[model samples]
Target: MLCCFALSLVACATVPHTGRKQLNFVSDKQLNSIGAKAYSEILKREPVSENKTLNETVKRVADRIGKVADETDKPGFEWDVRLIDQDIPNAFCLPGGKIIVYKGILPYAKTEAGLAAIIGHEVAHAVARHGAERLSQQMALQGVGAVGSEIFKSTDGKLDEKTRAIIGALGFGATIGVILPYSRTHEFEADRIGQTYMASAGYEPEEAVKLWSRMSAIKKPPIPPWLSTHPADQDRVNKLIESSPDAQKKYQEVRDKIGLGVQLDVLMDQSDRQ
Candidate 1:
């Protein structure tokens, strides 16, 4: 059974953000549930920000970026944005269109443009389906461990609490630890998409570079991006500079169309349906 499963693992998988090809053991359905579950748990643990102004700010900026994710071919997402009152300078979007932004990131994301960068990055994660993708990779790695008991074949056995916990933990580590930091490639890809999204939403494309410069400077204790799996500050800054022209053009086009039509409303409504 292990040998058969090993053979089957050779087939292709898609990296969420980059849409690059890779091997994945976790099924799309499985990964999605993992994200949905984790997101549900997170929402329960964290308090939703009731600051009406801040919530509106997050929603407005997130809405604009969502409208601008065309280049990413963003699947219709339930565009609900919540500002959680936590000081963890982090934000993330789950596979099922759930987005959470912690209060700590507010300072780093000063202006709306700065916030756009962060939103763009997180939304890029959802667009690329990075959470699901990472979870799938983890399931595959877990498969290697399962080789001992041929446990994967015994679906009933594998679903036991202990086994399920191990698998769940693997998926979590992939998303939070490995995938989050190691997501530079995903980050770079998200950066491109986010930049375009922000630009299309009337924010300057050049702001991404500036945002990263400040972001880079904020490492009270510095760590290597590649080694840590986060993006390299210099690399991100350089790419933003290189792509600003295209981003700027996209922004102009988006600006002209902003408030000119009701297409985005249709999108938001559709998100509710899904």
Candidate 2:
């Protein structure tokens, strides 16, 4: 127990930009290995997008976002992005900077800037090491439960199976009740950092707000905020709108240094014609 606690203290680290303290005992290599394996498994199960132009566009935007993330957030990450032929309106970035975009999300993303918002946000989750932090927290909680069980066993009285079951339930409750809220915090932090990345990459940051607003309007049954893993769409949209001005300033600076970004609509139209 003492050893695990000591390790947790030593492994404490702060997230970039957000400056939030996180307990991450997992090593980058370990997390990356897990991410890589999972990514490979997913690719084997799901078909990669065959539309050449759409695939090219996804790579292009992802490359720009990945470059900025490398410079400011996660340097030397083995960044790779691919478009999957799925109709689900979802995307994700794995620990080693591997990103997969589902085809169904393209319509909602609307333009290159909108797609950048989605990619940037997902990549931000990786750059911020949210996955590692969550794993570390779970491990720590399990360790705590183990220690408690040990202490109970050492006592003069024997603990019944019912008592053990109660201890397990407490751990489960802690995970859902306490840890889930922390996950929501990570999502909001990712949204903020993601917009900044989009700006730094020469994409319009305000598009993030627009992207989420569109997401809010998408037809879907609502889940209560407390029971869901992600923040409510309206709440997320509000935060993105509030934070976009700062991101826009960064975008303007990047635009001044470089030429205008690629035209997403033209590229999409071209893809459609093909």
Candidate 3:
């Protein structure tokens, strides 16, 4: 068993920027192909925004962030960004570089710099291959569960009720102890790398801190950090603040700085008027 576990470590990959080692048993080509197909299906099913200005803004910000990501990691993702006319305040980047931003997120984004922070974070998730890493972790957990089942089998090769209950408890413990925490780790890592990406792309890194502050103020019931997939909003804001100095240095080095850039609310008001 020790030798087998050691052998699995050979499949570990290092995350860009962070240099954290991650297990990745999944094939990148297969995962990216799946991501591309899912992105295509989402485009067909979701309402793609027809608002020219919003679409342009999403593309522009996402492109700049994506460019930085590509240059840094050189993953060669076929990057595309689209605005979805939905009330959801969220954005995500699929494995092959499909970026989707919902219209509702604009108010929170507030400015191009804010949007860059958001997109940079999502792009970091893709560039770091978090999706594949997550899938690999799940597969590893399932394999462990299967092995446990075999070990706890009764004399007649049946799973006794006690054994089944124990297995279920172990699975629950793993979910709470291992899986959920790793998700929060991913979120924090994404925030760190995303802030850097925005800064490198010539957007002010402080916008990330301000953006999270806005997020923390939203009047929603909160889940405890241990129970949640994301770190608490305040915790995230604090982390961004702590990392701002480094990101700011990157921003300072950029030749073409776009500090805060265009105010998104102004564009929204104009769109509403027109």
Candidate 4:
């Protein structure tokens, strides 16, 4: 237990953009290797979109976002993006910059800027190494469970099985109580960094707020912020709105210099119907 505590103290690392300290014992190479294997397995099971236009559009937007992320966040990641033929309104970026966008999300991400917002958010998660941090937290919790199990065994049935069960439940409850809030914090941080990435890539950061608003409108019953791994859509929208002014300024600066590259009106309109 003392050794585990010592290792955790030494493994503390700062998240990019947010600068929050997190316990991360996992190495990037190890995490990326795991992500690569999982991503390959997913590709085998799920159909990849053969729609050339959708694939091209996703690639275009992701490449722009990846450029900004490379400059500001993760320089060495081999960023690549693909569209899946799934109907689920979801997207994610795995470690080492493997990104997958679902076809169903295209409706909500109705514009190039909207797509940028979604991609940026997912890229922020990868850049922040949230997956590795979560894994490290789980490892620590498991270590705690192991220590507790050993101590309970030492009791040699002094406590009833029911008491042991209750203790285990309490440990699980505590871990959940801590980890869920941490996950929400990561979501909030990703929102902030994502807006910045979109802004840097010359997409309007305010579109992120609109994206979340659209998402909120579609959900029949929204998950409460405290209970979910992610913050509520409304909460995310509010935070994006709050942080967008600075991002807007950055966008204007980028636009003034580069003239707002990559207008995708036709592509966006076509994607919305799909």
Best by TM-score: 3
Candidate 1 overall Cα lDDT vs. reference? Answer: 0.61
lDDT of 1 at 267: 39
The positional error of residue 1 in candidate 4, measured at the CA in angstroms, is 18
- Candidate 2, 80-111: lDDT as tens digits: 88798876555777778888787867876888
- Those runs of model 1 whose alpha carbons end farther than 4 Å from true positions after fitting are 1-19, 70-74, 144-180, 222-232, 257-274
Ranking by lDDT: 3, 2, 4, 1
True-structure RMSD for candidate 4: 9.0
- Say which prediction, candidate 2 or candidate 3, comes out ahead on TM-score: 3
For candidate 4, write residues 150-268 as lDDT tens digits.
Answer: 32333233545433432222221111122233356878988899999989988888788987787666555543321233444687788889998999999988877655434345665
Model 4 residue runs over 4 Å out of place are 1-8, 144-182, 221-231, 256-274
Residue 165: error of model 4 in Å? 21
Off by over 4 Å in 2: 1-8, 144-182, 222-229, 256-273
Native-vs-model 2 lDDT?
0.71
Model 2: ten consecutive residues of lowest lDDT = 170-179
List, residue by residue over 124-203, the lDDT tens digit for candidate 1: 76676655444445556555433112223342322554344433333233323333453566667778877877887877
lDDT of 3: 0.72
lDDT of 1 at 14: 55
Clashes of 4: 0
Give the number of the best model, judged by lDDT: 3
By summed lDDT, the worst window of 10 consecutive residues in model 3 runs over 170-179
